[model samples]
Target: MEWHNSLAFAQDQDINDEFAAFREEFLFPQNNGKDVIYLCGNSLGLQPKAVVEEITKQLSSWQQLGVEGWFNGSDPWLQYHRKLAAPIANIVGAKDSEVTVMSSLTVNLHLLLVSFYKPAKKKYKILMEGGAFPSDQYAIESQVRFHGFDPEDAIIEVFPPEGEYTLRTEDIVAAIEANADDLALVLFSGINYYTGQFFDIETITQAAHERGIPAGFDLAHAVGNVNLKLHDWNVDFACWCSYKYMNSGPGGISGIFVHEQHHRDSTLNRFAGWWGYKLNERFKMTQGFVPEAGAEGWQVSTSPILLMASLHASLQLFERAGSVAKLRQKADRLTAYLEYLINGINKDLGTEQYKIITPAQQSARGSQLSIICKSNGKKIFDKLLDQGVIGDWREPDVIRLAPVPLYNTFTDVYHAAEIMKEAASATA
Candidate 1:
């Protein structure tokens, strides 16, 4: 696999991209009179062109089917969720039965905790990363309190050493082992939302299982960003949002995974609702809670048909891409090219001017490269936005730039760097 090191190389790669035709499938924002270089797919993916057709089909169904839409219509509203199971399963690395489309990410997180986090008096602690997403932090705090324990004592947040931007694999393993006796569950993000660090999930799962603790993940940033093997890794359960890498719109449906081993455990507790009832006999309206087996049992509300339709269109595109491996190969090369361009720009500007904080190594991170601006982060970021290069800002000094394999091009990355180099020189 040879790669060219110049802008022409990136342009040539795009010219020869087997998936290049798929670029027209989304709407990219234009600045002044041309398309802006979009590297913020880490936060929100570009919309799929097919989404309009999918949404239109559902609206037509609503108009034509009328009262019969619930049962008699084409792609009945009652069974709408079934259509998405197989495709959603592909991206998350699980069997079709092991995955299901459901509520928003945070909502699914709370529902999953109801079933997985069973803390005993002796083993009452939950393990997580210290700087998790703010929403996750709130969820953990409330869950700990719900268990009749104070968060300060029941939730153990593992942290990297001082001055470090990410956690080491060894440090994470040690934290799990040291707290094994009292740890009830190990819940973590597959990719850190801010730093773009990818954890060694296999090692973490192995360590947790050794202690008889169930392991789970919040894959909000990772489901579409990285390759996974949820079943092979024996992860007890996991949840993810599709709006980012899946190209679904804001607040799109989320997904869940549950290994087969736990599928029939009636003893595991859940906050039951009508939709979770056995699908075949759900309309029978029995007296007892006869939960459906597999991940579908986690569903608590009626399917959102319009949203599922939008997601279905995006999943079709993923299916055509030939799984995560195909996209990953391009991602590695494209992100590496972006890093190369940024470093060259920084060298020309001087070390005191700017720096790339994202990992220099490939295996440790995803497409997002977080750059620490030398001076005002917000000012530089605003200037870039003004110039039509759109990236995202984190807290103090880092700007996160993500080049998505599905729709982003190497040319986009190159142009973003050139714009930044200009902005840095002008601001100075």
Candidate 2:
């Protein structure tokens, strides 16, 4: 695809886009009476237009049915979460039985760690990417302490050598092999939240399995942004928050995937609760715990219907958009175009004033491009925000711009770049 910096070219792309109509499905934040160029889906997704309708239906069920809503409503509260399994499964490339929506991301991570992170004698360490989201670092550190191990010794983080911003697959695989004997688990983010680099999950999973280690991922950034195949890749366990690319509201419902191979493993440990009890026997209130088969067995509390409703609203849009594979086609082009436009800005300024740290390869990234402003970094970011170009800024130097395929347009990208150029020029 030949690149153009003109607004007319962007308009032409939008006119030809098959998913162009999806832009109207979301409600964007306003800045000075206009929709801000929303490039922050990687932080919090825009609210879906159908979210109100979905939540209202649930509220009405509660209003009329009262206590009987659990079983008597059109969409029974008891089994409401089951409806989400198929659609959520499609988004993450897993079988319905292997996936379940439940507690928040960090909570689910701790729950899964209980089952998969059994350290035996000398084999007690975990391998992960360095500079992971702080929540993951905290969760892993706490889990290690809970088992009476020093974090500095038990958690091995693989960092990029010196100046590189992302991890190479060969380096990651080598680290796994070098520490294979002592590693109890291999946990990684499907995409680094800061760098926007999508790791090779299948290769990483295979490396761990060959060494008899259980492999898992935090898909908070990768879930709806890139294609995943947890079931086919033989991932042992994984979890993600839906508020990001899935377009659920802030702090929305989280989901998990436990490979079917472990679903029937009676020896596995879990923090089970009444909600995870065998459905038929749940009302019996039996003394002995009999978990419902499959990933549903991991549920620890009653389903939060409202959060699920918010997620259901967004999942419907994903279903309508076909699959992540299809979304990625548009995402790759949009990100590339944004990359081209940013490069043009630097060229026009006659120097490298903005440096993109995210990988250039389509296969290695998702919808985001992380840029490092060489000078006046935060000042330029603030100016972009004031001008209604709403990308997120990280500490020190990075600004993340995500051209989401669902709600973001080529025109949005073009306008955002123009604003960015103006901001950079003003700083100069």
Candidate 3:
């Protein structure tokens, strides 16, 4: 579809969009007296309107039932996470048995690494993409050190060629092949947080498998934002935080996917707790750890009912809106229109004042466009913020604007772009 840099075109698109009404499900941040243009879902999603009610219901259960709430409530706290398994599995394209809601993202990554990153005398290195999220960097470094290996020697980072912003799939595959002999595990972000480049997970997983290495992914920025087929893609393991595109609120519960192929493997190592014990025998006060059957076997602690309630409310919206497949149809067009408008601004200014480092191809990116501001970048970002356009700015230069399909309108994109354009001049 041809995109026009006009509010009328945007509004018309919104009118035709089947998912437009889904935006009403969220509570937007206000500016002056109206909703601010919220294009920051890539960082923190807008709160779903039903969240408070969902929490209240859980709170009432606690008030009425006390400890009995675990077994006696309308939605039993004992199996609260079960309510989310199928829907979360659908989002990540995994079987219901393969996915589970568990601890925070980094904690899950570490637990997964313990099982998957089995180093040997020869194959003792972990291979990953360079410039990963800081938490990931720290996690990997510390994990290698915990194993009594020097991080610099035990970790291999694949970086883009000089001056390039995003990586090529071929380069990534080649790196895996090149390090095959010494690689213990191959890990990558499904989408790079800084550049928003969606990695070729299937190819990467295939490459690792061919080299006899297990592959994993940090889906912190990919889950719910992009289409995923973790099980079909043969990903050994993956984990993600829900606060971003999943609209599950700040510090929402994170989830994990452990392929069914790994489910019955008894030799795999895990830091176990009582929650992972077989549910039937969990309260038996068993002397040894007999893990539950699927991904739930990885759980290390009791489920947080409040966080699960927030996530439940959001997943219901995701179910009602159909799936990510339906959302992506509009998401692709929404992001495409944003790119068109940003390019039009450059044309009008007669200069490449802002450079989008994200891949131009739709398949290689999600809703995010990481723009490198060429001049007064932070000041320009501040101007947009002051003008009531809410996007996130990374240190140095990049401003990330994500027009989420669930709640963001094309008109919101249009107005935000207009503010960006005005900011370019105002800051200059």
Q: What are the lDDT scores of the predictions, listed in order?
A: 0.86, 0.95, 0.93
lDDT of 1 by residue, 312-401 (tens): 889889988888778887887788888877778777877645667667777777788878887877888999999898889988888999
Q: Which stretches of candidate 3 lie over 4 Å from their true place?
A: none
Which is the better candidate, 1 or 2, if ranked by lDDT?
Answer: 2
After the best TM-score superposition of candidate 3, give how far the Cα of residue 352 lies from its true spot, in angstroms: 0.6
RMSD of 2: 0.7
Extract clashing residue pairs from model 2. Answer: none
Worst 10 residues of 2 by lDDT: 285-294
TM-score of each: 0.97, 0.99, 0.99
lDDT score, candidate 2, position 278:
92
The TM-score of predicted model 3 comes to 0.99
Q: List RMSD in Å for every model shown.
A: 1.4, 0.7, 0.6
- Model 2, span 1-428: residue lDDT tens: 99999999999999999999999999988999999999999999999999999999999999999989899978999999999999989989999999999999999999999999999889999999999999999999999999999999999999988999999999999999999999999999999999999999999999999999999999999999999999999999999999999988989999999999999998899998999999988999879889999999999899999999999999999999999999999999999999999999999999998899999999999999999999999999999999998889998999999999999999999999999899998998
Off by over 4 Å in 1: 1-5
